[model samples]
Target: MEFTPVTHVLFDMDGLILNTENLYTVAFQNIVSKYGKDYTFELKLKLMGSQTHETANTIVKELDLPMTPEEFIIESKKQFELLFPDTEVLPGAKRLIEHLHNKNFPIGLATSSSEESYHLKIDKHHQALFSLFPYKTFGSSDPNVKRGKPYPDIFLVAANKFPENPKPEQCLVFEDAVNGVKAAKAAGMQVVMVPDQRLDKRMTTDATLVLNSLEDFKPEIFGLPPFDD
Candidate 1:
């Protein structure tokens, strides 16, 4: 599909910019292991881009874990505390963000992470990197975001936060989850999906483009400034 030149960029946090997806996978594995259940890739994909409550319930129902959502949350919290503090930035993520920042592009973060969870996900090592984005919509807790990904609420809210309030068509979103791609499309924006290798390519066919990693993204194709060679 063809797309117009984009003036604004919105990025998803977990799997797109950071290696939190791996961390999350480990946490989920640690949780399910206690019950002798495997937190398979398919299950991880379903939980990807989901909100806190949504993830808990999905885990309980899908895994048949004998625990309430709240209990799941409590158990998961233990693992999160240990794993989330030292996440690595995805390859090329810093370069891309810095390129956009230097060009003075209107950029923002539209993530499913709640405010509290956001802190855990962005430790001091990552705080400086993320601060480059002037606006961020933490969907799990933002009042203006009535719905999370797979809906347009967070994307719309992030887009509107730009000083120029660019139209949805003028926004380009970078995501690593199917629900996030759907959310951007629902908001009338073009999306580039850099999904997990375990996720089938067919699952991301709806995206404007799909790549194995952020390192493979080509800025000029989307009308953004290309990186220094």
Candidate 2:
């Protein structure tokens, strides 16, 4: 698809940049399994890109668990600290980010993770990569973000944080969740989705481009400088 003259880019963290989604799956399964509940992929899709409270509430309600949202949060946080720091950068993620940053593109992170969570997940392993982002909209706790993905709050906030305050049409978003695609569209931005193979193909129509991994991305297609091989 032809893209606009995009000048800014925003990224989603969990499954998009880092491999922490798998860690989350393991943690959720371990916790819910204690209550004889199974954490299914369908349920995981529904919670993707959601805030901490929303995720916890959905888990407790959907699985008929005995735990409260607070309980889930506390339990999950413990598992996260033990697992998140060990996550690896997903394929092509580091290359793409470094390329864009080296080219002086305006890029930021827009994630449902709070500042505390972001640090817990990334600081030990990927601080250099994150340092490239001048702006970050942490939806889980950023007060300026009154809502989360599928609501346009986080993406809009990220776009607005650019020093030039880029127009929505001039921004592009990289995401790995269905809700994230919806949010980017709602915010009037182009989205490139690198979704899980298990995700339904029908759900990807909203994305301007859908690729198996960041390695498959073509910068020139989005009006960005082509990567030199």
Candidate 3:
């Protein structure tokens, strides 16, 4: 099937590019479980793609935990680092980013993670991957903190950084969760949902395209010729 050409592409960092979402889930569950509260996988799915603070608050309320959002965030981050000392990039993620870089496509990262957390999760090698892109926008850098995922501020910030010609509508966003997809759509950009195994069923609808994995993604699908076979 023919696909619409994209002038720019925006990527979500955590789940879309890195396989850190499950690690996060484990971290949250571990911490919450100690308080005699369970952080189920379904709950993790519900909170995926949200800002750390927002998610922490939700967990606090859901599990009746005795911690403030700030406290929970600090504890969760510590646990996440312990649980996932070595971050793993998703399948085909590095290749896809390199391919886009080689083609000089304007690339950007729009995620609900804080800049510090983003860097911690991405580290040096992944930061090198980011250097290949001309522009980037992180959730912490968003001017409107009140509006994060499911609000389009982050994606809009990234899209606006591109040259004035193509506009947001001409850009494409690759998201791995419902909130990210909503944010991308709210920005008026075409969205491709690369749903993770842990994603909820509700997250699957109304996406411009849905695929099981990035392994199936071909450059030709984005109106670029496939570089391999």
Using lDDT, give the best candidate's number: 2
How many pairs of residues collide in model 3? Answer: 0
Can you write out model 3's per-residue Cα lDDT over 1-229, one digit (the tens) per residue? Answer: 4567877888888888888888887788888888888888778767877877779889999999998988998898798667554788888788888988887777887778887777777674476876786766767546654576888888877777777656777888988888888888888888888997756566688588888888778677777547664
Flag the better candidate by lDDT, 2 or 3.
Answer: 2
Error of 2 at 64 (Å): 1.1
lDDT of each: 0.89, 0.91, 0.79
The whole-model C-alpha lDDT of candidate 2 against the native structure comes to 0.91
Candidate rank order under TM-score: 2, 1, 3
Q: Rank the candidates by lDDT, best first.
A: 2, 1, 3
The C-alpha stretches of model 2 lying farther than 4 A from their native spots are none
Q: Cα miss at 51, model 3 (Å)?
A: 1.1
Candidate 1 residues 1-229, lDDT tens each? 5667999999999988988988888898888898999998888877777788888888999989988999998988888888888888999899899999998988999999988888888865799899999999998888898876788899999999999989999999999999999989999999999988878778998799888778888888888988878
Q: Compose the digit string of candidate 2's lDDT tens values, residues 1-229.
A: 4678799999999999998888889999999988888999999998999998899999999998997999999999998888888889999999999999999988999999988999998788789999988898899999888877798999988888888998999999999999999999999999999999999899999999999999999898888989999
Reference-based TM-score of each model? 0.95, 0.98, 0.91
Provide the RMSD of all predictions against the true structure, rounded to 1 decimal. Answer: 1.4, 0.9, 2.0
Model 2 residue 37 CA deviation (Å) reads 0.5
- Candidate 1's TM-score reads 0.95
